[model samples]
Target: MTLQTSLDDDAAWQAVLARDRHFDGRFVTGVLSTGIYCRPSCPARHPARANVRFFVDGAAARAAGLRACRRCLPDDVARDERAVLDAIAAIRGSDEPLALAALATQSGYSPAHFQRLFTRNTGLSPAAYARALRSERAHTALSAADRVTDAVYDAGYSGPSRFYAAMKGRTGMEPSVWRRGGEGMTIHWAVMPCSLGDLLVAVTAKGVCRLSFNETAADLAKRFPNATLHAATAGTSDMFNRALAGVEAPATAAQVPIDVRGTAFQELVWKALSAIPPGETRSYAQIAASIGRPKAVRAVGSACGANQVAVLIPCHRAMRTDGTLGGYAYGLDIKSALLDKERKA
Candidate 1:
């Protein structure tokens, strides 16, 4: 691509090299050799640096006497977006998981290609997305229904057995336990100090169930009234240490397993938040778009607010669309400090 004027030209070039879809629509890439411009994330072969330029937008590129490329159609994001939305609707409306090949064919692309496109845009594989839909539906139903059997059946499960089998990992606990708010589970929690104040890490057998700031055993007691809460013993296990590592140094910390609950959309928002690197941030709209629900920007903010575990999920990495840090549950001061810490790391 030919060089062009930009305040952060080097950063734009890096985004091009990475094919960073996050930069799509922010600018258009103009190729002098081909005399056509494309989106920054165009899968088309990169032109030589001397042959390319960047424009503020597609109109700017067109004004510069460049046409749009066909492959990555820099101006036709809506077409691919429609295909993605249609597929998502189908997935949510289905009682059973749609086959990848079938969904791809319906979207007018090969299965392999469609899989990549779908995942790249939505940050989830088709099957995984379907599973999330199923789990979410089941959970919603369970919350309102008196009987688990009826709830599962109503949620489109063939039987209670199948529902349990399918929701083995998606849920924080068994259907009954979850519905009863940890009726039969045991949670151990400990309060410790960190760069932030008063870190509370609660764990179950599976993993950390909750992590937050300025919480005590009494706080844990209130949150899990139905469960048994124990203070950490003198010999806290390696799992507890791992959870602390996640809180103290999340950027390089090993993957810390979390056994927590969330709604379907919240789970998607959380997954997108986790995908963000330590030093980088994503706008709430960007997170919503990554999950193929760009219109749910406000809901994304709600999900961030609803986060039970802090730092590990990195809700602080999300900001308002205008690049300002939005509200945080703890406080803005803590959030700003966490961002600064990560960036420095």
Candidate 2:
């Protein structure tokens, strides 16, 4: 199938300038002067704009007589992303964790080589992925099982203690609270002015469940629709203030707890966003590729749009494949200012 994206040459050029990884497989850059093609995220010194021609894929670049870039290895990267995706599917579908040797055999890669490739592509080792899968199953089971013990067993854990430990480590909440959708939850929220604009933060006992810009308590009510919402008391907890400060100065945002929720793929996308260093940026394509779903660029964008935590999760770091700013839930101006601040810091 042909590699495709909506980006035009001018947009693609911007991605090249930013070394945006999201556009890596969406398009290739053919340098007229060097007769070589590279992925958009190539770290080599960029060629002059006039000397670069964009192609939908390396085949097109090769047809134009350009040799593939040794640095980016675009084709190999795509294949690796696809292979990791297949491995993830197998892991998620299996009742038990597949052995590393078995997974390597299925992917036609040597054990050592496959482990490295899988980690490089997904930012997760196979074992880590399996653990995450079990955690997700346990969380789902908790929501429907008649008893916590039943849920633990149903999620494939041999022991309830293992499930309890994992849940505490991941969510820092009681299983009953998680399963009941924030029942008996007291969420303190306040809207405050900041560099970006109006910042709204809602915190559960577990962590920050919602942090957004230009939204109101009414919006929060709609989001939780069920949980109690209160203005920050005369003196909120230090953790609440730290979360607020994190939004005000994202570059220095402390790693406070977060209770944000989403589907597995959405969570993966958010995790990738949070890992982007301050002042750095990535395209949706790069995020999708990082999650081993290169073809899910559009889905990645949707996940970004659905993000509720704002600067804490750093959703603003996600940009257009062309390095241009894309949509933001608040506004483009706010997004631009946020990026500028991070870059200056």
Candidate 3:
């Protein structure tokens, strides 16, 4: 089927003029005057509207005696795919971290330019991606290995100090604790009715580990399977009460300690979200920029969605770049109500 089967001719022409990547691959832009065709997102100067015709694919354009443009290489879908894959393979193969310049060089791209390209395509900078790969490897080793020290080194960490530094606040548990799937940890949990829904509050002795809406002990069991999940009697932990209060009136909620866990980048995102004033809001782009990763806006949104503790970190304060409520785990209605409550306060 042709693009005309789905996209109208005028819509396809508008896409060419806008250089929209969303339209690329659905059709080719054939210029009758120059006998050249390009992907919809091609950067070449726009041809006269009368000279342009849309084709279903490169083969269709070639059949009409049109050659593909050299710049965008409309026919070579695997060109950039191979580069991204090769860089990923290089990062995973080496025991040590690869430098940005080195990885960009291997891909025949300039360091600064490739940095943006890699981040845009992967939703992570090359360095962050490498850390994530190493961290995943470390998690696997730590979960099975008998000795923490041996597991750290086995995961390609330079030393225990670096491993601890890398994993600091990542799992919110000591290395030994993660090794046993929270074997030694005791999590006190309770489900309490709240303004929005039933709130699940689970805490370690150190701080509140989770605060979510409509979740239960069953959900808590999945996170800390081996750990003892004690059903706390009412008035058990003052911290849990404080957390419940926070869920109701976030502005006046006491500062309760948090024991949530996430990646290094995710931690940065959470920190930025927490810094947002209750009545105020920040765009996803602003949050990404606050953490010194301006191009990581999409990554910031993913981190927000991954957040387990609601209202405490205040992911609800995050908005779209266009000044709209993007989404919330609970619902847009809840997000709007929270913002309204904050604004009224």
Best by lDDT: 1
lDDT, candidate 2, 121-231, per-residue tens:
666789977887787788789888988889988998879788787778676467777787766667899888777777888887767888888899998988886577788
Over 74-107, each residue of candidate 1 has an lDDT whose tens digit, in order, gives 8866556667788999998887879998998888
Candidate 1 — which residues are off by over 4 angstroms? 1-18, 31-34, 42-60, 70-73, 234-236
> Which digits, one per residue and each the tens of the lDDT, describe model 3 over residues 1-345?
235545678878977887865455568989989999999889999999999888898888899899999999898533454566678679879999999999999988889977876664455688988887778778888877989998999999989999998886566667877877777888899998987878898888777888888887998999778888899866566877899888777775438788776665676688777776787787787677555455688999999998878888899999986578998988998889888878887
* TM-scores of all predicted structures: 0.88, 0.80, 0.56
What order do candidates take by TM-score, descending? 1, 2, 3
Q: What range of 10 consecutive residues in model 1 has the weakest lDDT sum?
A: 1-10
**Candidate number with greatest TM-score:** 1
Per-residue lDDT value at 96 in model 3:
92
lDDT of 1 at 105: 85
Worst 10 residues of 3 by lDDT: 76-85
Q: Candidate 2, which ten residues in sequence have the lowest lDDT sum?
A: 1-10
Candidate 3's C-alpha runs over 4 A off are 1-147, 154-172, 252-254
Error of 2 at 267 (Å): 1.3
